[model samples]
Target: MRGTIVTLGGGGFSMADTGITPIDELLLGLTGKRRPRVCFVGTASGDAASYRERFFDAFGARAHASALVLFGQATHAFTAPQILLEQDLVYVGGGSTANLLALWRLHGVPALLEQAAAGGTVLAGISAGMNCWYEGSSTDSFAPLAPLRDGLGWLPGSACPHYFAEPGRAERFGEWVADGTLPPGYAADDGVALVWRDGALAEVVSERPGGQAFAVTAAGETPLEVRLLARF
Candidate 1:
């Protein structure tokens, strides 16, 4: 299906201390290709070279992995947007959400991403990466946990990541949704991901066995069923 986006709470292949996780396998499987072309967008982390290397190190063997650099090094002649449009999947790195949004717009990435999505390219990311796709999110991009309502809006409502790993995130997200600071939306624990397909919640998958995901509204929080990837 087109418009498939996987929003991970945290702990991606590069972010994790160990090897590839179930989340990684699950994402690659979505491409329905033997060796998918995956582009790592590290703009959120300011296009850090080490982060890019970590990405390739994690995925080099199984996929045609490449990183898109936006901090002055535009080595490829085709253009950054072209690089994204060509991928089977685009994985964004986590960092300051505010910076990510601004830079994406300037580079015309959001529009190209929409184009890529329309062509069946899957978009995925953790934390800030996840936060940027929704209408809004509770983020620490401002040096404090705050409400950021300016997002790509590819997916409706809001999103809250690191639900389990971050202390007080559950209460804060619930409060924001209830008090109208943010729209009703989904939340995910670290190592868990919410897969949105064709603009609706499609599946919830996790690397951790007991990891939780939630559907939070002005009314309250409802738990969503999570499928542990390792079991499958």
Candidate 2:
């Protein structure tokens, strides 16, 4: 079983549009299914109703859009595995990365998602969602930007999202890698994504002009040329 992981530094269906952005359009196309059923897991935001609404509003017109709310109230009936594995795409919403990981473990979401990925579901997400796929990441989920060592490890190495959106992200991440706190990994600017097929980076896509991705290691950060796509 092979799979693809789309890691976004920022930007996606949640960005709000009468139509989807190019980056999101690319993600939908990866499913290889017409009108694919896409499930939004909003555990990071504590199952925020507004976030769920955003998902439906963005994707409902094009796909069978739905959400899995693990807090406050239940919105979907199927079990985690059922919902995860049966879908064409499973998108994770961003919020608190630490909390997201903790909650996911509590509900066995990690295992279910791994199963979904192994079965060839297109797994994608932004921010914390992006951070979760790597062995570790540089995140602000704990207040300040810090090294988050615990991750699902679906992709090799580490990751850092919002590489350019946040000030000092590049500097701090470099320092972490230099000091051996975080492993060398990839990073992306807002509105950009790193696409991995079978655990190897296959492409870089961006919705905004000048949006970028990078390969950051102990030596230094090197910019990855990305193909920019026009907005819908």
Candidate 3:
């Protein structure tokens, strides 16, 4: 089945309260479902309560929004298959990619996510969430920028978020891909997302002017052509 996946390097509504994020609006549009149900999976960051509150303040009024908290008392039902598969969009938050993966596997969240994706549910996220879909990614999960090759493999290659925002991200990501520490992949700056449709890249989109995405390889890094979407 054809499915859509949007992986953002950073910049979205996840931690914002000032205004609705354009990138988030783009993700919601991809669902193409009325009053789409958007669920935030916050296993990362230890399901911090502040994260949940910010999420609701930003997304709750616009759509049927809920968050899946894995630690402490569960706010929403822990039924991954029923809840995740039923939603039009599943947005994962950024934090501790390693821990996120571990907990997800422990709770069978990965399988349910795969099922949801196969069913045409839009899967999208920023940072750690973005990293989970590829074969691998560069992350700070270990408190250092390191290559982690244990992705869910929903998409090919690797991913690196905060390409420019982080001091060593672009350089380290390039070195890893070049030396075979990690495979060739995509890197994105804050406010940009790499859009995939049916396992192929359809486009790169950005919320802010000058936000960019790139294709990194042993050869060198080349900018991925991107469209700057206008926000009303």
lDDT of 2: 0.86
Residue lDDT tens for model 3, 1-232 = 2588999999898645565698888988888876899988887778877777778888887889988877865554443445898889999999989899999988888888778888888999889999998999999999989999999888999999999999999999999999999999999999899999988999999988999899999998999999998885
Alpha-carbon RMSD, candidate 3: 1.7
Better of 1 and 2 by TM-score: 1
Q: By descending TM-score, how would the candidates be arranged? A: 3, 1, 2
Residue-level lDDT of model 2, residues 1-232, one tens digit each, is 2589999999887664655678778889999988998999888887788788888888898899877767756654433445787888999988888899998888888888888888888999999989998999998887889899998888988889889889989899999888889999999988999999998899999989889898999999899989998766
lDDT of 3: 0.88
**Tens digits of per-residue lDDT for model 1, 45-87:** 8887778778889899989998777786553323366689899
TM-score for each predicted model, relative to the true structure: 0.94, 0.94, 0.95
Error of 1 at 83 (Å): 0.7
What lDDT does each candidate get? 0.88, 0.86, 0.88
Candidate with better lDDT, 1 vs 3: 1
Model 2 CA deviation exceeding 4 Å by range: 17-19, 74-81
Q: Give the Å error, residue 9, model 2.
A: 0.6
TM-score of 2: 0.94
